[model samples]
Target: MTVTYLLVDGENIDATLGTSILGRRPTPEERPRWDRLLSFARDTWGQPANGLFFLNASNGLPMTFVQALRALGYTPVPLSGTEDQKVVDIAIQRTLDAIADRDDDVMLVSHDGDFLESVEGLLDGERRVGLIAFDEFRNTGFTPLKHRGLQFFDLEHDTHAFNSTLPRLRIIPIEDFDPAQFL
Candidate 1:
C-alpha cells in the first residue's frame, strides 16, 4: 500500500507564522492541529500518512508538545546541533532525499527553500509530491515545480487545520474569494 510521507518543519512554520504573517508568536490556540494535517494527507491522496515532525532541540525537547504530537500520530524528530547548524533542515533534506529513492508519495510542510534540491529529485512524476504551507509564505523556488506536477495546498485555507482563523492577508483570486466568509 502507498503511504504519504508527511514531513513537517515545525520551526519553519512557527517562524513564518510569527515573523511574516502574524508579526507575533503564535499562541497555543493559534497553532495548527497536527492531526488534521495527517487526516488531510490521508484523504488527499487516499493513502496512509506517516507524519514526521521535526523541531529544534537546542533548548531541549518540549516533552509536552512531543507527547501531544505522539498522541496525534506524529513521530517527533528532536534535533540538536552546533550554534550555526540547521539540524532540522538537514535532517528533513536527507529524509527527502531518501524518500526520493522510494515509490511512495510525499508531502512537505514548510516554507523553507533548503529542501528545493531534494524536492526536485522527487519530481520524476512516478508518484505525487506536495508542498503544504501558507500560500503567501511559500518559497519561490517551489513555484517552478508546479509545472512539473508539484502540488501546493494551503495549510490553513485548504486544510483548515487551525481551530480559529489566522490574520493573514493574501491576494485572493476572484473566483476563490468569498465575502460571506468575512461577514
Candidate 2:
C-alpha cells in the first residue's frame, strides 16, 4: 500500500477559514473539529499513513487545541517566532525534505505562496503532492500549483462534513444590541 501523509499549516488554514468563511478569526470555542477535518482529508486521499499539523507557538494557541490535535491522531509541530519570519514555513520545508526521498504521497494544507517552490520541487522529483485550502478565499496563491496539474481540495466546498460539529454563529437582534457603547 502507498503511504500517504497529510501536512497542515495550521496558522494559514485557520486564518483562511476565519477570513473567508467565519468573517473573523475562529475563537477557541469555535475551533473546527480536528477529527472531522482529518477524516475528510483521509477519505479524500484514501487513508493517510500519518497526519501532521504545524502551528506557530508564538500565536498563543491553547494547549487544549494541541491536545485535541493529538486526540485526532495528528502530530502537532509548534514552532516559535514571529509570523513574518516564516518559521512555520521553514519547519514544514525541513520536514518535507526529510521525507522527500520516500515513495509516499503528500497532501499539503496551506495557501501561502511561500510553499510554491517546495511543491514544485516535490513534483519535479516525481512525488504526488496535493494542496488543500479555501479556493474561494482571495490570495490563495495556487496558480503555480494548478499550472503544474496538482490536485486541490477546497475546505469551503466540504463545509457540510467539516463544520458539522462546530457550533453555529449566533446573531444578536438589532434592538437588543447597542452600538454606541464604544463611542
TM-score for each predicted model, relative to the true structure: 0.97, 0.74
Q: Write the per-residue lDDT of candidate 1 for residues 58-169, one digit (tens) a residue.
A: 8898999999999999999999999899999999999999997789999999999999999999999799999999999999999999999999999998998999888899
Best model per lDDT: 1
| Alpha carbon lDDT of each predicted model | 0.93, 0.70
Off by over 4 Å in 2: 28-30, 59-61, 82-84, 138-141, 159-161, 164-183
Give, for candidate 1, the lowest lDDT window spanning 10 residues.
20-29
Best by TM-score: 1
Q: 1-183 in candidate 2: lDDT tens per residue?
A: 666688888778777667766788887656555666677667776756477988888767779978978988999888888657788899988777766777777877777887777776677546667877666542456666667667776654453336434323323358756677437
